[model samples]
Target chain A: MSDEGIDEGSRRDGATELLPPHVSADFYLWLWWKSEEENGKFAIDDGRGGVEVYIDDRIALRSTGEERPSAVLTGESPATTPEARAAVAGGKVPRDIRLYVRRDDRDYHVTLRGTRVSIAQAKLPAQVKSGDVAEVLYDRMFLYEELHWIVACLLRAFAAVRVTAAWREDLVPRMARWATLDEARAGG
Target chain B: MGILKGALSVRRYRVIGEVPEGFRDLWIDTLNSHQFREPQSSTHKGEVVGWAQAHNLLDTDFTDLNQWLYDRYAYFALRVDKKAVPAKLLRAHLQKRLEAWCKANNRPKAPAAVREELKETLEMELLQKCLPRVQTWEVLWNVNDGWAVFTNDAELPNERFQKLFLRTFGLRAVPWSPLDELTGTEGLAEAVAAAGTTDLRGRGA
Candidate 1:
């Protein structure tokens, strides 16, 4: 609001604010890296505490047990990857968390930080102005929710428990209406 | 930080308890009630108490205090306006006054009582003029999903927002953590729920 003051784009520890992922490593890797299943399914435990899903040996997702907890899926950091780490060590500026999501044939590495998230295409540049976090969030929220939809499906699959069942009953229809998934909120 | 731009530094929360009917009124009333109030020096205490207000982000005039639900989202800009007279500023005034009192009273130094008196007087005279800092926070509410995102990654603003939200909606917001993802599968949801475990996954919930 101050006309002259510098804007602190995203607060410190941007990576810490996301909800952890609750993905299955073996199933996730197979689905993510090898298979072409439209549902690319995994298990979700709507249990107490945060769940860490090792999508692969390299990337993992951590989020709250509650369906809508804040921090969405996060990937292994550039610091953890040998090549990326070496790139940083070699003075190639390492960004924040890089989430690799395979859609169709190509894989997309979505980089995320405190208030930063972007689909990194080596051709086009990553998000530059930190102030653009809001717009970027607007664009990418569905992507996170898309992953969450899978998380919800996984939660439903784990519905042998009482809580997931209740949620199943509450949500109505075993699965989310993915046809207009992003637009689902509009009707509601 | 400066009202979310391209990125949304989200503080995810799970809404506990069903939303009360006519949440629209509750939301409006609460927002109006908490809108920033101007600071004033207390004539009795001779001190200026700090005050905070929320304002509009886009409207530079800051008179836009209305709410709307469009595309299943209630879009609004939250700008928190706060003003405080730092202790050091008050202390500096006290220091100068103390010296003057000592010189006039023919004493080596002013006593605690006299210092307090001078401080009280000085605050009344100068504190009201101190300007406050303004911070803007953009909020997006997915009424369908029952979760909202603020364009900030701050502990204080987030906490304040939670308090205001509960007061407005009569529902609680648990800051989304990695732990929230694993809750409610079966007995675990019960355990956390029964224990009233807030931030069971840690982070000083």
Candidate 2:
């Protein structure tokens, strides 16, 4: 009825009918990696809550309450074995590792290995934005600290590079600032 | 009774019971001397009455009053004992009447072959209407089947859109599952391709 409604209707019709199905899958993976690198960590603390990182199905590190932690983990190349390749091609990962974190009483999971995940592919009930990666990472880190009562500052530092590498190429330069900040904060 | 008498102007009929105000126009005393008797003529009159009754234009007994009217009108002079009817049967009779009317009027009839196509068209329309409200990335992520199970986020509250997505795509909103974590664009591509292939198969089938 309204102009906006008409426009939206047309846009959706075009998107559903014209847009190729495979679009955005590769972009999402690239974006995921780039965002990871930009933040230098998968999770961060903003004087309140920090992030937790999981690598290869293991809890890699967590940030201290004093600072947020960001974590990133890259999966190994796609499984090469016949069986593994079959599973991957069938949308199942036989040998991939997963990352899971609990923060603010909520748990979030990301895959560290194998196939790239998409909201559509993962069958998640809601769409995920690039911004959510940082937020969830922070929350998971916070939960890791509270629940485990262990320091993971070094692991957090190690995972930061993985997070940064996931960002877009243009954002790489700004990531240096993030790295510097991480170092300074770690030293202090 | 008073309204029916006043409305229909029949002298031989008696109102056995009162009909609801909404069903008044639908009720008629079959035994009335003014009743028309030709089967076809009665059927046509019954149709008018049935339409009125369906729309709740008159108030009267909720019993098979519509059918009673149709049968009486269709036969023109049906026995009074045969007049009492059930509601569900009355509804079916009314539907038949409507179908006949459509045929007579040369309106498009819904065929079995076109039913699925019609449903798909309606579903697509609903989805398009819902697109803008669901523009956020979080919402989009939850749009798929397996992904929605892992991410327990709420969907946009467009009932039409929700129904369309659920019915057409087998999508449901649920908490995010661990399996979803391993997915990426490649998986999505594969899924889309699979869906496309299935669509083609369905067409051939």
Candidate 3:
């Protein structure tokens, strides 16, 4: 948790804190792409271990300009729907998504909003049922900390790859192909 | 509800500004000073907000740091109490008073100023009789990491929290968004700032 090497961006003193929220939206879209393309598997070098991400039951698509701009799809594997893929092809990015993430043996189901990357209704992995009161409290806190760490790592992985030219040149094209092919298959 | 048990919904913020020397004592003193207290009878304010223990909202005493400060994390709750008088009841009471005054004065109708005064009086009386609604949100702050997790994501509560945090800790807290984290990196600032929505359908943007 030492921010020693991490550079502070808009966080510098006297700098404006306002930041474009589109990055988070893009991250969500990227996460969706990775989840399907990479088969929900990602590795990190920080030593905490790799993460497996699964698209859950809910996904929200947002358009920057339109009369009707946002769509929320729910039920089992909403991300697999033609409408979901069509929405993306129609120039909509994911503004919110539900993901089931597994790190080590722990599992977390969380709904993430793109604007501030807010986590909602997060279901953490079960804890040991029998332990001392203090131990139980500590266990709960450890799980909470682990959840934040995994999420931060996920974002970090995305940010690391997103800033590269490959994101626009290579990654986006593949993502585009995936969206269109699936959309066409679904008769979108 | 998020801190101890139940589903978690939280907003995260990074504490800004330098941590002055003796921050431990400073935080303890600030937390104690800002402890939850009932509103005085004289003030027209119906709502009051302050800090409380995360374990028990009713407990505002933070004299023992061990109760809340665990390892590198500090745990607490934001307690808000609001007194609300039912509008219909207040209107009914005001009407009764206004009619009585008009009848005594031999006036056909109550004057606007008199009616306003009667309404205020009735409202005060009703507020006194009404119980204040109590609610609490848990906050888990990682002092070492300089970030905090607030249980509630609603606009008003988060605003209140930021204001209270600045007043108590003498620091500003900015929401830690994905952009912020990415832009914090050395070379990624410009790239992240320039990022926009991408069309993923093999379609032209």
| Best candidate (score: lDDT) | 3
> What are the lDDT scores of the predictions, listed in order?
0.41, 0.27, 0.76
Lowest lDDT block of 10, candidate 3 chain A: A7-16
Candidate 1 residue-wise lDDT, B60-105, digit = tens: 3222324344444555555565555678888887888888888999
Q: Name the lDDT of candidate 3.
A: 0.76
Question: Taking the tens digit of each residue's C-alpha lDDT, what string does model 2 give over A1-188?
Answer: 23112223322221123323222222222222333444423444445365543322321111222122133233452221233222222322122233344444444443322221111111111222234333433333233223222112222222233234333233333333332333234557
TM-score winner: 3
| Local accuracy of candidate 3 as per-residue lDDT tens digits, B1-205 | 4866778888877887887888777778889998998777832446788999988888998888888887777889999998888888888888889889989999999989999988887787777777788989988887887988888888778777877777787777666643455555666656565666565654533
The complex in candidate 2 yields a DockQ of 0.02
Which residue pairs does candidate 3 place in steric collision? Answer: A9-B184, A176-B200, A176-B202
Worst 10 residues of 1 chain A by lDDT: A115-124
Better of 1 and 2 by TM-score: 1
The superposed Cα distance between candidate 1 and the true structure at residue B2, in angstroms, equals 8.1
Question: How big is the positional error of residue B134 in model 1, measured in Å on the Cα after superposition?
Answer: 2.4
lDDT of 2 at B98: 54
